[model samples]
Target: MGLESNSMPKIVIGDFGYTLEDVPHLSDFIPDLPTYPNPLQDNPAYSAVRQYFVDYDDTIAQNIVVHKDTPRGIHFRRAGPRQRVYFESDDVHACIVTCGGLCPGLNTVIREIVCSLNYMYGVKSVLGIHGGYKGFYSKNTISLTPKSVNDIHKRGGTILGTSRGGYETKKIVDSIQDRGINQVYIIGGDGTQKGAAVIFEEIKKRGLKVAVVGIPKTIDNDIPVIDKSFGFDTAVEEAERAINAAHVEATSFENGIGLVKLMGRYSGFIAMYATIASRDVDCCLIPESPFYLEGRGGLFEYIEKRLKEFGHMVIVIAEGAGQEMLSESLNQKDASGNKLLQDVGLWISQKIKDHFSKERKMTINLKYIDPTYMIRAIPSSASDNVYCTLLAQSAVHGAMAGYTGFTVGPVNGRYAYIPFHRINERQNKVVITDRMWARLLSSTSQPSFLSTKDVVEDSMDDKKETPNYALLENGFADAHK
Candidate 1:
């Protein structure tokens, strides 16, 4: 029902190996900012709580599983209510906006933000900015209240609506200033968060009191620094239905092949997790792990082997997988500047048919299923609903307590506040060498799809590429210290 800080102490082991940066605050730029007792201290809803405020020094570690001799690494400020707040209840005018693509828990986050502000802090003047960042400048604002968004969480998509690539920092901040809006809640994916960071810089440059907070929204679960994005569980759950259908269709006919495509533009969490859950998939392909079609230890050879043994097989692939193998060159991008991906599911389906009917001189039945939209438009699962509620409430508490230019999400099962740059800089990808991938390989008994040269090159690249953000070892100050 409520959230608390992990309260991990900052431990610096070496001189040049670790850095911890804190999120910006209204007081950071403005001088002598006044503080008031948190409104929650008087609210009957939180009265029974023993500790109403999080410690200022409370933080969560970024790397929890390092070796005993390794450094403690980075830590983020814990997310919760602060004993003193900057804005008075009646003085706060907040607005919520959802950008980029649709995700399952968008409405849940929106509902919780409005409800928390109204019931928890008595901040009734909440406005919903329609149609992404452009809404701030072009569209009329919709007044939001606890009653207005009561049943929204049961539905899919954001009630405020969403879009992409309309981020003009000056105009959006102008709208905020003109309307006297001090709190801004932005919900979107990586690109949207990048835009949010720009907006925060612009606000700080203009000396505005606006608090810009981001809630990372991606069904792909690619946003880094968080355990998983909010709607990832729901997406994985919905993807299983498609995998099951593919399995039935494949098993029904002789030499049948079921090919299912799920969402994962850059990361393959959906396809990986969904395939593992189904336990019927013979192979799972993602962007992180390179795959080949021909030659020994190739996808085609594996498919042939599986078909020979089982008479039928299922394959699940992420949307972003197998781009290099495609004959067609799709050098295009969408509104958010994400590359338009060629359909790997269809390509592999055709490839499989050709390899059997044309190359191998054998007949094979192939079924292609693309349930990307269906999975993206459904309501969140029970667990996701609770997770979204916590994220939204933590965001509200942080904004009320004057934490600005940050995003809120769970780190190691504990909620924490992170700077926008830390998350937007790089994505959280599936590690091929990790235990999870090993488990998937063990379950499917599929080849790694990696050659000796690929393995050597990957190792060289890992050693050569300096981790600018992974450890945050350089170019940032130790804000927690």
Candidate 2:
């Protein structure tokens, strides 16, 4: 067997399908492989020999290589070696900007980026853009160094500051060109990624060679394909604290109910995870799962039954939940153009109060809590700090490798480059049929059929209505059956 210093070990075939003679030599394919500088040479964390190029034929089991279209578009392969970098460390100028609302790991990401670029790549000219996209044109920049961002990850929020609704593509591109920044890192959510795409297109239109990279920053964990977004773990952890407080307040009084509103405009991951973590929540309301207010088998009826049995109940709700139930027109939008959802927590509290006072002639104690901003402004958890570091490192690696017009995130359980168009293609919503939802339903023991279709079917049933007391005494399963 031929032994190469920086290549895969040669294996001898005995009774296997293929023999050593049948395999092609690596030298035949990569005769003149370029030698790239190894920054992490002293560190044992990274492998010395990196797989720079991957062959699709090598993944096939057959002896003959077939070049046919696969079902999933492409075969899986590891990233090749890092040889082509767009910027030279000594002369390159880079800018980092944050946009959208606050997330737990925003500062952590910024710190990691600056540290990696300064230490790993020896980049000297690092500038921080303040106030999101508007800062790009307004020329609000702060000089960054390894020392300046060393302790930023220990704090919450972003040192560069952040905002939304400033998407001047032309002016931003002009500013980038004027500053001679070859690489730009943008950290934000869906709207911010959209803005990055526009800025990238303008740069390309002007025939400029600027690499624009995005770090997917959303506490909602609504970005698709990726397993989870940074700061999401911290948000869920903090939201659990609010849920705990709500539980304490609810259980203190007779027939009391605690309602908590969490951040998740188009998704429900935060509410779902927080409810699961708290384990004391009796009901969970999310944007994906709609619930009814007044009916034979509705939320009000369920609450009445639970209160009768358990005396008190704790409920967690996403901000976007039950907006359709509200009669008021939703004409307002925030700086990022996201529709301002109705206050579902307050609405549910009021509805419960009105139903008990007028319909049942009973008094109900409900505590309304909105912990959206509180959760967003806090520092990141230990889990998120590690996640934010990996995300930032992967982003810098991709940006250095001459990859442009893409975002860096974990795809298929590995860190890889994802195009901006694919990142913003659609919103990632909670799958109602998935195991997560099933676990939530099993834990809370809430009515499974809060959906509109289920409510309509129940209303259309000609069977006699079961008594609320009987349903409470038995279980929801017996009542449904």
Candidate 3:
């Protein structure tokens, strides 16, 4: 929501029975900031729309589920083109930077951001910051236009390039101020968003008129406060190919086992979803559920029994799954300070082979397939392409409206402006007790592989970590109006 009828800005509540956490605005620091009519009103491209401007009090609910006793829940400022913007089209200068690992739809987001700025707002001076945050000082800036990014959506990876952990807020903010970039679009995961938040703080400390907008990007679908990240759909779609290949290999030989490793550093959505989608998978392992190798209710016993009955089976494991069973030396950290995970695929594969050959005195054929980089290096699926477009446009809209220190994403099917701290506070992990995980268990017929104590502990932990939008009454009408 953008325009204010009165000169005074609306009050933003930090937290009450309901949460109205709004993003920072230029008006928050600078008094009597000039407002310009949104260029979209005069653009022929938007002339066909009947109603375009978002209401000042419009918001998107974070949680749609409610009970009779539910208190007012969390809501976020809705994202869209506003009638009045804080920045004029002629004065606006924008730059975009991508960080962290490669993912599908990265290029699509870049292409759309450039295109939307030029076509919709008639703001043509868009710069692409090469590499990650270090790109501000170390790398060259390339001018981006609709013409330059026309066919980039068909490609994989980010055109701006990316790296891990080069966040120097002072240096980055200095670069922005020196270059006259009023709008900063950051595309990356939680770590990158954290850096974006710091950059916003530094920008504000200097009393500069800049808007920093983050578009959450992760193939893992692990970012919180959003329904799902952009490339997740494409990652799930591509995983089906690997699962099919594994099934083919496993079914070809007697006593065969197909081991497929998927990318999920902390979450298991990819492995879980792929197992459910492929139906041929006999077992799925993820970081959320612990599994043992020996004794009753162990993975070895289940695998042995399954092979004896069916002659062949497929096992899908997330990269982060079974980390507790790995060597302690593998528990290192990367440049981004994320724990370096050991290869669970190879370890489990060898263990299965050893158990069958040495313990059971039998020979078994096993094949392992790692499609981690393969999935990340491919272009996004059709659905993800459309999603990237929407996310890019939303970031542009928020920046133009002078909303700073915010990230744009679809929460409960509606796009909203969420503050950065909410996302980086914690990861969006897969709840083992959720019905979706139960569906995966049903599909694969895999044992929960969890002890009574583990289950109880997890349940208690979930209860302790209540969601931001919890127990809300029907205050949507009263809250907004």
Candidate 4:
């Protein structure tokens, strides 16, 4: 008896099973999925995995209904009618895992999925794929039961565990297929999501109908349309809290500057949003704007003046802020004679305070603080409660609607689906729109302390006299101005 289209798998919050519609294989859904060059056609790792896949296929592929198609999520198909159910006591199973840098509210996502899926549709066989994609192939999985996952709602890190690496191999797909893992939920940023797509393609080729769901998990909150990634709010709150504490210190001393850096690889959402949300920040440096170049001294000078006038300064910088504003007095270096660039937040603070102290002969004390791991991993604030739960519920809804190969991003404040593979497409870093830039420039009369024209330049031969303010008045440098 095949799963009839009319009989959708009924799913209620307290019910016993999820609603699944037809799911197709790659050739049926999107024929253009990249066919990888089978590097290890018969390697032991590949063989073992492939065998596992085929064995499972043999066990459930025929007469099993949901077992014969590809794991392309909810992509449309033109082939014969697809299997319409996800959890067949004989086949369907679910899983999740975390990977890469930590972000806030990870546990909430895991807890919601486990509880909802278990209670709603009896999709009780939820496994945690340990160590990201690597754990998938290594097959090091930890099972998550309703009981085990109950109290995880208030947790911070991923309870499912995570890894950072995996290989693109048929064997890996086959192993998963053999395990009856019909669906997988991955929580991570671009890299991990891209890996999920790769695995989806591989299993699709073999015609095992598995669904792959990706949750955009990054503290950077740079992923498009998601209206703030899972951990961004938490990270920003923590950063602001730290900045406020630093502000108190700066004010108490009546003559100090605090430079702080938040994480965002090539984006400025964290730095920009935190600065706007938390009013204590005097200046914010983001990858969207030039940091360590010439013409970038204005902000530093402006902050210095503020400290001199108002008694304290707080500057928020992105980790990827270019290495331009280093002062000649502070000795900074990396192993390669590169401008020693860790703790960029601190570097900016030091450079600005140093400029005023060295030039004005004022005792402008400085403290450089980089809350790299701290901000990212802080327990999510109360504000995250609503958003985190909503996002996790959204993923579940997307799955129930038979949607796949799409990312659920926030649009006009509502979560909407975007082409899923775009998660890895790497949208260009957010450029400061001319209008926004003008508003920022006009909003305050604070002139830039450092020029934007110069980046960090350290004399490789000598260690002293680092970070000089080179006047670089140009388009890129205009960000600071």
Candidate 5:
């Protein structure tokens, strides 16, 4: 239940073209480290409360075996208590920077990091790096103190601001050296973490003792091995409002269809969960499930059948879903090198309209709602605030403990330090075969497959039979045909 027996820190060789020789061993520079001072060691109040700290079990147990090398799986130890830190209080100078797109808990994480470094470790020289990685070389920094970041967590967004796509290695290291900053916390997503790994490798190559710790920040919740990233719960909560609005709009009019697009560049957690939470969604589409447009049991046919059964339908689709259906090129990328996904919501809406107009000479009123910016700009929810605070505290603990080239996140249901190499190995996507997907299917009542031989054979059997227009007098046949 504790990582103490197998608490060997592993050196991770990053995927940023760094070889094994480039990484430094922990024993090389940090041998015989001193334990953190116990301020409560001599206090009379400590004797009564000492059992709380001594018997604490913050190590998380894995549900299944993650790797063959470790049969019991990986266990993440809590980063405080009697653990020794590599940096001295007055000698330590730390920097915090936020990068990538906006998430709900960025400001909360920043505030917690500043507070932890100042109060817990008594680190005085904490600096807020502005404009992300460029802030290092650009000399845009604000001196951080306990008073400066006191009320920042009350608001949303980062106090230091954020940017993307500034991974200049030499200039960043030179600035670190010139400014005498020994510890750095980079908060962002996958691309930002990759840049952090490169920066750490550069620091090690220069033989500097600077520690780089990453705090994973992605609203998409796509980081590998992390149980849930900060801002995801808030995003899902905010997205529910949009889904509810769409449902109201769809059901208000005749033959109404409300199509909503949420953020999920490579994965579909937001769309999947929002559909489950909203409960009014007729169909849910995501990047994990490939959907077709005009087959026997395709999306269009499903919508047509739903309209016939209930006069209206609500669809929730992730941003990255149905990208293959787009005929245009997606060569453009954002500042973080992420591919710009095509507008699938608009495309689907237009396609549905055209299909109804051209094939059946019928009109379908469809409304498209894109609430991506609104969801990402909101403040953190109550759950995300707690999650972000814990992440920040753990990150500061890792940096103080001389752990570098790693990200601090909740892994296997516990807050743990995850190496960057493992993060970049693969993307975390929703498994369509999982219980979550099964729940989604049950909630939406959508068919699992877009096309099937049985569906085609049944259509062929229907075509072979004589036409039955007895219900045409009731106006149902005219409305559909």
Candidate 6:
């Protein structure tokens, strides 16, 4: 409870095309030796990754109460001397890996590193850590090459695959020590970041030379000060695609409600942004605003009002919108002091259906979840591409310059690499929503949803924008037409 500081670290950020004289190169996950390598469908590592870190069948529901008390906070390990040094010697090799959930632009990040290390800088011993940290210890190797990363800029999912359970054991920690891996780039979400910190702590504890650089890789945009995660734009673009498409369907059907959910548990940025970008979303629910029954009435009543006003409405629900009503997540234990993730998307949909059924006294048939996976991986959005590349470049630069305990984030729409010198420092952390983005979503019409100001009065500061209607001069103009 005594971690406090107020200065951002000035780490060196290696450039994509520019190289420094004193900078050290990172490792490539691909092994120098390649054999008839194939994958096992039931690789033991796969089980651990899905079960321990990234499983979809984990029976989640929209519960709001669980989101309070302990918010979704990521704990970073204080870096000593391991994750700071660069792998300059042949004895040391560096590789990038993704663990747990699939990020939108894993390929962008990995591609940037591969390009920078091999083409820009002199370091070319980079390897691809297949299946995440487990691959670091696995007997297999995925060496980097011009052929290996060819056309990866537009690909989705990790070519190396990912796992979540690799960091929970001593053997995994020792495997890095044995293999002489100097550093590992971990590109993943909260769970993977946690694993990165744990691995860093263990690697340093074992006196290993490997560095672990954790690039914020969630489409959820929940990570700090980076403003938005690498894949968030890609996911939002995909969501916008789906939402806009659904609007077409809603129009063609003449009288139907289309609901699509996005992947933001503790933040509504995705839901809000996607809605803003598209021309179909009628309402959006995010974690920052909890649902109320009595004072704010029910979501159904609001929907009914929208129906009365617009005949049909499209709703964009953030997955984490219902954290206030649910119990704490099992992962965030009783003593851990972390709140649970709420799934209000599903709840809001259900509540609408229930309300419609009662009000009309008829079975309400509606479409809600259009969860398209790997939207983060599609590599279509320019913002995501730029963001991923900046992160990779900054990561390499930060390492060569000796920066630790920090995550590279996007600041002012550019990669402003931030180091966590203080555990409880809020300045280094990215604010979820700024006035600029809020002003973008203030319109009552168009794709983005509008809510009663009183319902989210407490969060108004975070919601207000500088008001730039020029970009959306014709907000929801299509809807009226």
After TM-score superposition, what is the CA distance of residue 182 in candidate 4 from its true location, in Å? Answer: 0.2
lDDT of each: 0.86, 0.74, 0.84, 0.57, 0.77, 0.55
- Judged by whole-model lDDT over C-alpha atoms, candidate 4 comes out at 0.57
Which of the two, 1 or 5, has more TM-score?
A: 1
lDDT by residue for model 2 over 1-481, one digit each (tens)? Answer: 1111121223335332433212112122324423245344433445554653332223212122334542222211122225445456776699999999999989889988898887777788999999898998888999998898888888889999998884677778889999999889999998888888777666655656667888898989888656689999999999999999999999999888888999988789999999998999999988777667777668888888899999999988888877888889588998788998777778778888999999988778889988888888988999999988888887777666555666766655566556576567677878765678889989999976444454566567854665222112111211100
Cα error, residue 82 of model 2, in Å, equals: 0.9
Best by TM-score: 3
Better of 5 and 6 by TM-score: 5
- How many pairs of residues collide in each model? 0, 2, 4, 53, 0, 38
**lDDT tens digits by residue: candidate 1, 1-481:** 0111122322334354565568888998888999999888888988899998999978787877777688667788899999999998899999999999999999999999999988888898999999898999996689998888999999998899888884677888899999999999999999888888888888888998889999999999989889999999999999999999999999999988999999998888899999889899999998877777876557889899998999999999999988877998799999788999898888888888888898998778899999999999999999999999999999999999998989999998889999887787678888775677778989999877655355455666776553221211221222211
Q: At residue 167, what lDDT does model 4 achieve?
A: 50
lDDT of 1 at 440: 91
Q: Give the per-residue lDDT of model 6 (tens digit) for 1-481.
A: 1112222333232333222111111232222322211121233543454332211111111111243354422221221112223434333366777776677678878888877655533466777878776675566578886567977978788788876553434666676667766667778766555556566555555555456677876666665544566677778778887787666665555346788878775556677778777756766666654444323334566666676676677777777665555544435622112344545556666766776677556444467665656464566468778767777876765554344345565544444334433112221221224452355446433322223344455245565544222222212111100
| Residue 284, candidate 3: alpha-carbon lDDT | 88
lDDT of 4 by residue, 1-481 (tens): 1111121222212122221222322335444433322223323544565222111111111111244453422211111111232334324487777876677788888887777566543466888877766776787888888788777766666676655544544665776887877667778777666666666666655666566667777777666534567777778777777787777767777587776777776677777767766677777767666544223345545665686678877777787666444443335543212233455655555556566677667786676677878876566777776666766655654454344544444443554444444456553354564454334434433333343323323333344654564323342422211
Ranking by lDDT: 1, 3, 5, 2, 4, 6
Off-target runs (Cα >4 Å) in candidate 1 are 1-19, 451-481
Question: Global CA lDDT of candidate 5, please?
Answer: 0.77
lDDT score, candidate 4, position 481: 10
TM per prediction = 0.90, 0.83, 0.91, 0.70, 0.85, 0.67
